[model samples]
Target: MVDRLEQSKALASQARLSVLGWLADPQAHFAHQVTGPPAEIGVCVTLLAARLEMAQPTVSRHLEVLRRAGFVTVRRIGKWAYFQRNEAALADYKAWINDHL
Candidate 1:
């Protein structure tokens, strides 16, 4: 069904930009962060960049991509920008795609 295909495509889009991928690969992308959550903690851009050994601007670009794809939500806390998994949105997207596709 066209609808099903659309649903799958939407989720695929999200997965392509998942913050989960970064969280899943903490050693690779989470090492450089100064003070960040563990695997149990949500990944933040600054921490992620530190872990990834990348520049803040670069990490921000990646985070922006994920945020746009509906994979993560960014909230500014004081002077820090915290990124969290959009679990509810992701779950809803998965369920819709599963039901339709």
Candidate 2:
């Protein structure tokens, strides 16, 4: 209960919300990768950092927050980390929001 409230509060940041929006439509928000499309796996941290116009470390910290909030999921392909939205988690979050507030 209290923990859920705390988790919800953690996602209140503008940066985290923006990250979720980009992830919502990876193909639309992100560009195609040399290896493949962002939709195939997930958007790479480098691309996300570039799009956000923030330092890699800063973007990474935002991603970490989203990941902890269950709004994003991470996959590592070699040295790079890719991120995708967790639709189920988002749906759950939405429901929680509706119920709580």
Candidate 3:
């Protein structure tokens, strides 16, 4: 019983942390259309920086946080780097939390 509780506690903490990480960078961590509706893919670093009125390096640091947490993925095209949510991993994590908690 103790072990099970401990495991659940750990998982709950991790799930909470992951959600925080995913939202850490609303612009850099997500992609959507500038107007009208949101896009299927996330935004690139340059675009995110423009939207946030921040520097590329600053946005980069936030992206690193999300990437390390397994909440986002990065892709490079030329000199630009794009980020997208790892939907599968996030979905699985949410499912686990919903089941255990």
Candidate 4:
């Protein structure tokens, strides 16, 4: 389960919000991946790093924050890890926002 405060903190970061926005429309934001489908398996950390023009480790840390916040889900294919939006969680978060603030 995700803590509401942690999730709110995750949403406060521009980098992390950018990640979520991109993942929300992976096909348009990201190039077609060879390892797996962008929507199905999500975009690779390396690809996200390149797109964000940031270091892989930095992107990974951002992803870790989002993952812990329940805004994204990660799947490992061999050595590569792909990240996709957790749509249900996102909807729930949105509803929570509506109800709270």
RMSD of each: 5.4, 1.9, 7.6, 1.0
Q: Which lDDT values do the candidates have, in the order given?
A: 0.61, 0.82, 0.56, 0.90
lDDT digits (tens) for residues 1-101 of candidate 3: 12333333433444334434544554444535353112334456666666566788876776676666565677765666667767675676677669978
Please report the candidate that would top TM-score against the real structure.
4
Task: Write model 2 residue lDDT over 1-101, tens digit each, in one string.
Answer: 23576567668788778878888888888766665578878999988899888999999988887787777899998998999998988888788779978
What order do you get sorting by TM-score, best first? 4, 2, 1, 3
Q: Which is the leading candidate under lDDT?
A: 4
Q: Give candidate 4's error at residue 87 in angstroms.
A: 0.6
- Candidate 1 lDDT, 1-101, residue by residue in tens: 12444434444544334546666565566655555644444556666666566788977876776666565677775677777677776677778758866
User: Residue 85 in model 4: shift from native, Å?
Assistant: 0.3
Clash totals for all candidate models: 6, 0, 2, 0
TM-score of 3: 0.55
Better of 3 and 4 by TM-score: 4
The TM-score of predicted model 2 comes to 0.89
| RMSD score of candidate 3 (Å) | 7.6
- Candidate with more favorable, higher TM-score: 2 or 4: 4
Which scores higher on TM-score, 1 or 3? 1
Off by over 4 Å in 2: none
TM-score of each model, in listed order: 0.56, 0.89, 0.55, 0.94
Clash pairs for candidate 2: none
